[model samples]
Target: MTDARATPPPAEQRLHPWSWLFVLLQQLRQFVVPLLVLLFAGRRGDAGDFAEWAPLVGVGVLVMVAVLQYFTYRYRIGDDGISIRSGLLQRTQREIPFARIHNVALHQTLLHRIFGVAEVRLEAAGGQKPEAQMRVLGLAQALALERRVRHRGTAAAAGGGAEAASPAGDTLLALSTAEVVRLGLVSNRGMIVFAAAFGLLWQAFPERAAADWLQGFFREAMGYAGTLHLGWIGMAAAATATVGVFLALLRLLSVALALSQYHGFRLSEQRRRLTVERGLFARLRTSVPPRRIQAWFLQETLLHRWLGRRSLRIDTATGGREDDPRKLRELAPIAPPEACDRLIAHLLTEAAWPPPRWTPVPRRCWWRLFAGGVPWNLLLTTALAWNFGPWGLLALLWLPWSAYAAWRQAGRLGYAMDARLVAVRGGWWSRWWRLAEIDKLQALRLRRSPLDRWLGTASLWLDTAGAGAMSPPLCIRFLPQAQARALYAQLGRMLAARRLRW
Candidate 1:
């Protein structure tokens, strides 16, 4: 009776023209190393001459693919959701409902910036990859789409209403240039970069060449000091000074990199969503819904504590993987202790500060924790004794310090939970305080190792979806079995009473 052909087609849209170049560049980056390897691998003379043309051929093929992709890809945004049609030979279509959209992230690369376009990524809960993405869109168009999605998502969650109101809050926190510098100083980014660079160099070049280069540089420096006729003690001091200077330079480089990445970092909250904008070149704009946040961590390194500063990071459920840089997990990379407190208070209105009581781990657990370090100390002592004879016996001195450190850690280890929030505090030298909403908890694990069983104790782990595999869940270790059970039951009751927002 009714012909489907009579129905009007959904409005379709294409990505910015610059997206062709973006896609081409991405393909080249992905294939560059393999192409280079094929071109250079054991090739000589004529073979190398042919290889030289290979790159151009590869580029031509990539350009053709990019152009084809651009022509074939199309997306439709309608009242209910978004639908995408893509691929050339093996065509594929994907439809995403507004209710399933988790977060929309906007990113700009150097190329995008030059062309005044942005990349938009759509993340969905429990997804291993972005649900959908547009390589390039006009900046205004991307923002409008993001706002529309957010409005639709909010309305859908609220059981239908007028479009959600526009973001309605002032800037909560803004980082100054000085604070950005502090972030660099407090971060170990330089060491990470240097280590990565060294690893790549070692892998690419001959091991002997790399080793010789490092040895030669150090030997030349030492030889110059030798000309000063310094005694053995003085030579040792010089070496130490050199190492210290090198470390300082590394730290400086780390700081510089931080400065470049987070040059104009700004954090603002509006309509229960947090916005973070940062980056010197490849600018990023991230929006985080309050319900999506799984937990918050307040971290203070020894250096940070000395400077009376702290950093705030949040774990969100929408992040794809640990290595995703676009996640925008840091709330405050560097801030004054007082400012951090204010931000925490603003975000978690239900949680009280200076919590009414902190239940410390049993003092008896100190020896249990301390004894765990004994084997490592013994190993060190054995190595010293083997290499330095009786002088190595001095390594035994570490036992007392280790014991004291363990004692301090046991004293510091504590947990507090209320109807709405659960807080865990621990750390040896650098302190970390983790807070999570009771409703956000997804699972609970209880375990007792052989030694723990002997000690009549158990450990409780509170699991949340926000934590990555490498990031341990909230753990309360060395608690009496009875107490652990009691706390677990209490938490279960709290979790049952509240509906999970994420």
Candidate 2:
């Protein structure tokens, strides 16, 4: 291997010739709402040229910034690392070693493909932003860099780097059209899309709140239904049918979105690194090492179970704290339960799927959970009764409903710790499993809340150095205090002597 210390500065390279255009569009997108607000608001008032000139000025500024960025940005790929230098007045330079760069993400909009270019982002741990981002680069150049980082870890000496780049790797999984449909049915992306569209609409008409518009529409619908002179039962049926139709349309939209988002989905492995490539018009391709994956998640909802499928995701060190739509955290968006099991087993040989023993929490904890929710149930009932008179007493039904749910959940709440992995399972209708390798753990602690202390119980909290920041934590809750302490100490011992692969 070449010595990095003695190496000279590598040749500096520029981005694609039309990089400025992409950068301009990206900048324009961020200010589109404000620009439109200014333009249209001006039109409504007495501002003559200001309306047209305001947007022009904003676009002009953005165009200059993008052009400046394109001209100033420079990068160098060396044997051991990559160096980047950019900025005009506030210049900054960064040197990122391959060992420190954990993920290489590439994206391509339809325009990018038309120009034979892609956007590149190099993500490392502990940073809120990507380590280095190239707005536009020749597709071939981006692929070469991805390969360089892929085999930089344990396989450097094995000639694994010489074989082929990202696309040539072995595909472990590929989603068919039917699977995409299943994924759509299981996902709530339609809601997210609707929310986004609603937000845009609100921004477009700042004075007209979405709530007001929706309320007006609902009132109109109610009046129209009353004009039908149908009986109460018929009206109820009509309302139910309307809701059902709306839900059906939402599901259909979700299906179309899933198909477009994951049209050519594939999960491949190269050396010890995993790569996911997906999207239709706008493509997203990302690669991260297995060692960077600190946690694994398996989700099976009521719908997923009925469909005979499940979802698998991983929390990787390279994942950013905030949700980035381009993030490829899903190992399997929707797959058969057996397929998910095999994939997990293959990806995590040490985890030992279906752990030999799943130790359930104290059975009596069910009462603790059931009683704990009583206050909220009572509060909800009281509010409803105050508003709706005696009929609101029906709200008390939630008490028993919640009690049964708590009982079932308490029964299913369990944890398993083997030599190499620790897994926690929770949830009732929407079940989940969070698994983390012992060696990958960053910290472990025994927690005791006031109520827990009063009840002589404690919780075992496990933390790892990766993403899943928004995911439910991996914790074994409501165990006897002493048992929790023992597990904490055992995990602490395991963590102390272990060596992190990444």
Candidate 3:
């Protein structure tokens, strides 16, 4: 063992003093809505005549509170570790060694951008919340700190500066502006429903102005034609849907514009690590090493399939903010088939994820999709229609929808297992490639419905624990009993090999 006295620690770097702007900004976000209500509502004599003076007093008090909170915030980075001192009523000090830092993220909301500040979130592998945060910091200082921490952290992880790669030499992958455009376009389809819902709610409650909770619900409902008249509702719903689709297209346009600024975005690889640096208005850099990855998946939606594209997702041991900082890495959209192959090869050991050893789903499963679901749904629809008149006919639509969905999954559902990998693909138009080392699986459950038992079929659901309360679940429906057991045994063996870390 080495002696602690043998080595001297390096000096510490104090973050920019302007970081207080972040605390101020955070206070603003939390207090603004209530403040606005107090001010405007009081203006109309809602709080009584004395309420007129309350806004001024309230504003002054709020400002003072914000200042005090900001004054109490501070962070320090030493050669050995990073220290953060924060919290308002209760003071908490957190120290994280450079070696344990998995990723660092810089985030700026519209408010932060206006103030020329950003938030720095430091993510560790095991914790749910960020290890620590310099809540508010000058944008420039935040970027500089990110560079410093990433370089130092990578150096520590590699054992010393001697093995640390240059910051510029570490990029592993990047998305071109064109590629970002493609990715954005494919995402447009999903946002249509969201936009339509918003529009319908706003349209419903014309009396209630935007941003009120009750008003928002009424507005979205009406905007989507939740109620009004049947003919008018249909027309409104159609119009709302159309508007939603268009807005989704516009969203993609904005993303494309943003990507153009980083047209030549690049990612560089060094040793077992990967780095991603991109964005124009606000730059971002994230780091992850291959060994820390829990899983890597490829998502190909109907739009992606039509466009011949795919999104890559890498799940890692790190967790904190929702962003990808804690992730192993998410590549820009790539060709579906190729992206699937590349991810599987990179994240899994050679012996674990060879070419898929796929087994076709049993034929009986197809009948379940057709006979079991559609008939019941259709029966419910017909009964509703019989009682409610022509309005009930809408329920009949279920038959067609279910028929289509089942038809799609019937030929598509499949499962494959190898020494190191398990892949399940089931979806009519959307194909998901979920790849994980057998050792990474947190739990395996074999379930059988009464129908499944009678049919000698079972469902296998796999999960990997993450910081989030709910980790993503991969469910394979209707595999043969024998096959499910075989897969379960294989997973158990792999987990045991790793001492059941799951």
Query: Mind giving the per-residue lDDT tens digits that candidate 1 earns over 1-502?
Result: 9897785755799998878989888999999997787667626545756677777788899999999989999998777788999998899999999767767888997778888889999887776788988888877677767766777744422211233223345687888888888888888999999999989999999999999999999899878988999999998998799899989998899788987788888887765678788888888887877778888888888989877899988888884876787886888888988888888888878878546899998876778778878898889989999999999989889888878888888888999988788888887788888878888899888899998788789998887886744343578888999999999899888888777777
Model 1 CA lDDT for position 389: 97
| Cα-based lDDT at residue 280, candidate 1 | 85
TM-score of each: 0.91, 0.91, 0.75
lDDT for residue 84 in candidate 2, whole number 0-100: 91
lDDT of each: 0.82, 0.85, 0.65
lDDT at residue 154 of model 2 (Cα atoms) = 31
Q: Tell me the tens digit of each residue's lDDT in model 2 across 1-502.
A: 9887884656899999899999999888899989999889988888788786898899999999998998999998777788899999999999889889888999999999899889999899876788888999878777777877776633322222334333477888899989999889888889889889977888877555767888899999889988999889999999899889988888888999999899889999978888999998899999888878888899999999999999998888874655796666888888898888898889888668978899999877887778887888788888989999998899888887888888898989999988888999988979999998888888777889899889899998888886447467888999998899888888888777888654
| Candidate 2 displacement at residue 231 in angstroms | 1.3
Report model 2's TM-score to 2 decimal places.
0.91
Q: How do the residues 1-502 of candidate 3 rate in per-residue lDDT, one tens digit apiece?
A: 9897775654444444555555555667787878777778888765687677776776677667666666776666666577777667899888888667777666655566677676777777776677776667666566555555656644432222322223446433556556777666666533555578778888777645665777678678666664655596677778788889877667766566546433455656644556665556655556655656665666778878787787776666787544443233565445456655655565454644535467778654776777777667778878988899889888877777777777777887776777666776666767776666666788878999898788787888887655222223466778889988887787777777774332
Q: How many residue pairs of model 2 clash at the backbone?
A: 0
Candidates 1 and 2, the one with greater lDDT = 2
RMSD of 2: 3.8
List CA RMSD, all candidates. 4.2, 3.8, 6.5
Give the range of the ten consecutive residues with the poorest summed lDDT in model 3. 157-166
